[model samples]
Target: MRPFDPRLVRELPQTRAPVAALGLLGAAAGVAAIGQAFAIAWLVTALVGGGSLWAPAVTVATILAVRGILSATTEVTATWAGARVAGVLRERILGRWSRATADDRPAPERMLTISTHGASSVEPYVARYLPALVAAAVVPPLAIVTLLVVDWSSALIVVATVPLLPVFAALIGRHTQEATQRRWATQTRLAGHFLDVMRGLPTLVSYGRAEKQADQVAAVGDRHRIATVRTLKIAFLSSAALELLATISVAIVAVWTGMRLAWGNLDLQVALTAILLAPEAYWPIRRVGQEFHAAADGAEAIDALLADVPPACFAGRESMSVRDLSYRYPGANVDVLQGISYAVRPGLTVVTGPSGCGKTTLLELLAGLRTPTAGAAEVPRTHLVTQTPFVLPATVADNLALGTGASPAQIAAACAATGLDRVIAGLPDGTATLLGDNGFGLSAGQRARLGLTRAMLSDAAVVLLDEPTAHLDPASARQVRSVIRDLARTRPVVAVTHDPELAALADAQWPLTERVPA
Candidate 1:
């Protein structure tokens, strides 16, 4: 992606209000800066000419106060805009990933980097670089235009040299683009490696290979440092070169003003204003160039994120619909669930099949979590209790709240219905116990009951269960089956279970078969 991608700017229409406000604040600050320049110039002229200095001093102080307020506002607004844009992008990225199949998503390590660290990098880009960009757009032109009106000769000198900064920076950038790309790739790989090694440290230690890999880790770390330093070196060199060019440009204007002032060809106040404004014109541009290099990674990351998340489509409102459904996994030779047609209403629909008949995939399709390869499916809002349901590290209330909103009584009722009331009651704080990681203290049966309880509490019209009874004993399974029976009374329920007891209660039973290759 281009370092200053306009699409990224476009992607942030939601952030336009704050960005626009920041720009306005920046423009106001620039105007105040110009006013300060004139005030200082007038003070110098008055002091030298033995005139009254009170008015110029007061003007200078007033401009300084306004500029200070503007600067603080710009900083706070920029910080807010940065955080808001990053959060918006992350939410969209995660939403897309959640709606997509695993095959469509980036690898875990890369996704984590983009969503966490990659998202964080945007803060500096938006806060520092964006504000600099606004200043560059506003201040330099304003300074040059003001200079043009005050002293055309100095303005001409300032204008002649400012373009050289960007041209020189671009030249340096072209020379280092390849090296920078390589550095970024290496940095990503090393970062992923560090995360991977740390996550697998226990496994490596168990195999007596943890210590041996320390050398590899150190080697990768050293390479990353070297590459990062090399990139920073290039960046610093470009900044220095731009600075030198800007300094020379300002000096040229200064020399012109100085000679004119010495020869008595220009007024003292005008000459001082020209000198003051010349540096402002050049430095804003140079600052932008410097910040662009610092913000390149975040810009590219945002571009990648925007590319990855396509526009969303709303789910249909049907209770259930399937016609000639077929699914062939990526690179597969044949469909897994081929030419299957089924429609279900608000009742118990038990689906039974041999181990490899794509029963779970069918449920996923109904839940709108996967698309059929060559069929039509319409399902309303759905809740799927997977074979291994998600159990988070949070309080029981928090975990249950992950489902549809319910009062304490409603939650307790759902728990009792799903045979989880006893587990909650036994906890130190009923419904408030913090399950460390994945309900760490809970048994498999308890997790199963919890999953079912949440599903029962969901407002979805369709609830798909994938082997929800697998982890339970006979008594618990019977209790859960009773809960499923009650859930079916309100909405459509399709459960994939090997338990004959659940199968017997089904109002309609679906027997699935694997698709055979032609």
Candidate 2:
């Protein structure tokens, strides 16, 4: 997208308030700036024509002061508005991301970069570039007309060279965009690599290969640094070139004014006013060029993120159905389950399978985390309990409630159903005890029981359990099985297990085996 594209600006929702404020501020600033210019011209004319300068001096100072105040206020308001807009956009991006595919996550990091650094950098552009550009557009024409009234030759010189500034700015912008894209790509690759390394640091250290991996990280960082330097160099060069163009244009206008002054075609007051206004005409273009580069990084970041998560139509309230379901790992020759068929009713169902026989895959399929490549699987609302339960770093009660706003009675009922009543009773602070990371302070059986309790507390109609008793002792496992069997009386329970006690407790059992493709 073009750096100054209106569509890109419109994509940000927060731009509306600032744009409106900018229009008002621009008008005020333009009038003030032009008023100050006119006052100076009048004062010069008065002094040269042998008239009083008091009135012109007062007008110039008052207008200049008001312009400064407006400029500061506009900067503050525009910064606040831009921050709000960027925050809203970032939230929307994340909300959309929750539904994105695994492949879509990495690219969305670009959106984060834009929302943070890009949004912050663009504030100056809005407060300064936009208002200045407006002033440049309006004030110059008005100033030129005033100069024409005094002397047509100076006005002609001002109009002739003003267009050069924007032309040069556009040329510089084209080069900057390419350089920024390259730099952004390098940063994204580095982030992905760094995240991967952090996630696998434990394994790398255990294998005594952490030092080798550190070298790889350093190499990635070096490449990122080089790309960053290249981007900065291009930006610096472009700014310098644009600045030079504006300066040269102003100089040419100055020389013409000097010639006119020497000839008697222009008075001293008219000549000075025109010279002062000459740089003002190019100032907006120079500011625009600078702001464009700053905002370009954010624009590029948004583009990369949006590319990953293209607008998608959500399947609204559609019930899931599966039948004769089977799945095999990619590149694996054997099916995880052969001819597995089941209709899951709306209630608790325990799923049991032999070790490494696709039990977790089946639960993932049921929970809509994975799609089966073979057969049909039908499910409505689902909650899955794995052998090792995940307890977020939070209070025990919060973990059990899982944000459902379940009443104390309901929470206790769930605990009882998961055979956790005794466990909670034993705690010094029942339901409020802090479970550290991974519930490390709790025993394996306690964690498993808590996982089951959490799943039970959910409002989901169907619940799948994969070896819920895997970590429990024989007595605790028997108690859990009994509790589960009691739960199945009202809900469809599908438990996948090789445990004979659990199998006998289940209403039905379906054996799973790897099947070769025909």
Residue-level lDDT for 339 in candidate 1: 85
Candidate 2 has a TM-score of 0.79
**Candidate 2 lDDT:** 0.69
Candidate 1, residues 368-453, lDDT tens digits: the string is: 66667897887688899997778889898899989578888998888878879898889999888889875787898898888899
TM-score of each: 0.88, 0.79
Tens-digit lDDT track of model 2 for 235-322 = 7887888798878877987898889789987778777877777666667667777766666765565554344454322232324445
Provide the overall lDDT of each model, using Cα atoms, as 2-decimal numbers: 0.82, 0.69
Candidate 2 residue spans exceeding 4 A from truth:
4-15, 44-53, 101-159, 305-320, 323-342, 346-362, 370-379, 384-403, 407-451, 464-504, 508-512, 515-518
Q: In TM-score terms, which candidate is top?
A: 1
Clashing pairs in 1: none
